[model samples]
Target: MPLSSLPAPTSSRRVLITGAASGLGLALARGLAERGDRVLATDVARARPDSVPAGVDYLPLDVRLDADWTSALAHVRDSWGGVDVLVNNAGVATGGRIDVATMDEWHRIVDINLLGVVRGCRTFTPLLKEQGRGHIVNVASLAGLVHAPGMASYNAVKAGVVAVSETLDHELAPHGIAVSVVCPAFFRTNLGASFAGADGDMEAAGKRLLERSRRSADEVAAIVISGIDARRDIILTDWDGRIAWRVKRFARPIYRLAMRRAGARIASTSHTIE
Candidate 1:
């Protein structure tokens, strides 16, 4: 369906977004607020912006905590009557080979990146069902579709996200709740800064990668909003991501060869342990 033909934002278009303090989450909140939707933005940090647009509200939330999700959803239910959208945009990244990475690091990454999405979906799916009509947008990544060395855990978690979201889309479609998984290539965000590391070199490498493929957060936000508007099941944020998906699907040998070449580069890095 065309974006123009999608459901228009009315007072009833209530949206709740996680990780709204910065990056794509903030951009999405601002865009949706500008479009006249009542937006409830939440982040784990206490120092959220003091003011948002008149229709936008801010809440404190830690996606890993069940209590936080419950409180956030209850607040939305009471204030907006029902939530029309839920954006599970909160995530963190960890880079290293699975074998070399510390178990603690692996747990932390999975807690925030994979299980966070799982928790969000588990908590909000019922709320969306209660509303009878709603959209769930889960932000995965281009990495979810293909393996990248040094990002073994990250890629695994994102792959799980894609699987869970696709399943949800099938399960929720009959109830008028549309689930869309967004696969975005690198974007200009503070995600690199948020990378947890026990050493300096790993952190530096993460920063370099973040800077390399940076795109404006607003651009990604626009794609997400447009996807929601059009009720698209899969939203690819960049041309590279689209191309990668096509190659992976129709040109398996070529895709595998490309992955092998990319993996060699990543493996050669002293910073990345195989």
Candidate 2:
């Protein structure tokens, strides 16, 4: 089917989001539902009715498990016929340098952040193909594009998401499926809960991230929705992210130098960590 023949994704779309119990995912679920989109919000925990939008459906989903995704997709298929938008927004953050980071930590982070997105895309893509049109949005971080100290695993996985989304956008665009990757700076979210390793270090890093947050989850949610509506393949949340992206692209040596200095400063004396 041609793009011209596909249904317009407006208020009528069936939207599904991962990690919807709190933070950005919860905000997205509520934002979409409030705007009249049929929204299904899923996470490992059930969302409080007070937090979820009036008309939204909540589910328990462990994004690392394919079976969990299967059950959610089944529900959407049975109830709404098919989903028009899929959000791979579940992820974990582990704060440590490579020397301090453990293999177990790496595996856990990769399983949820990178492979999690891959699994979600692999599972629902066929349905999008069958339906002729749909959109997939993967939530990454500014860490992906900008390499920083003490976030080795996070940087790797999020970079993978950006790379994967770019490839998917081109490959699936021909099939009428739009793919986008959203890279946002630090935000006030529950990401701290997913931090791994030393509790003290993690707590410090988590607090720093929260303190650096320039926007709220609800604010990010609105930008995300607008990005998807525009079919933007690469979505940066703030002007700071935009500036860094440009510097990284146009002045590689300078960006690398800054990152190197940053890495050294954090390892040596800085209090904040990404």
The 0-to-1 C-alpha lDDT of every candidate, in the order given, reads 0.81, 0.83
What is candidate 2's CA lDDT for residue 262?
A: 76
Candidate 2, residue 256: how far the Cα is off, in Å? 1.8
lDDT of 2 at 237: 82
lDDT, candidate 1, 93-207, per-residue tens: 7777555677887788789878889898888889888778889999899888876666777888899889989999999999899999988988788898777755344566767
The sequence of per-residue lDDT tens digits that candidate 2 reaches over residues 1-274 is 1122233455677899998878999888877776678898888774444666668888888888889988988998999999999999998777776666678888898999999999999999999999999999999999889878777888899999999999999999989999999999888887787775643464476568776787888888888888888989988888889999899999999899988997776677434322
Model 1 segments more than 4 A misplaced: 1-12, 50-55, 198-203, 271-274
Per-prediction TM-score, please?
0.90, 0.91
RMSD of 2: 5.1
Off by over 4 Å in 2: 1-9, 46-50, 199-203, 269-274
> Candidate 1 — which pairs collide?
none
Scored against the true structure, residue 18 in model 2 reaches a CA lDDT of 91
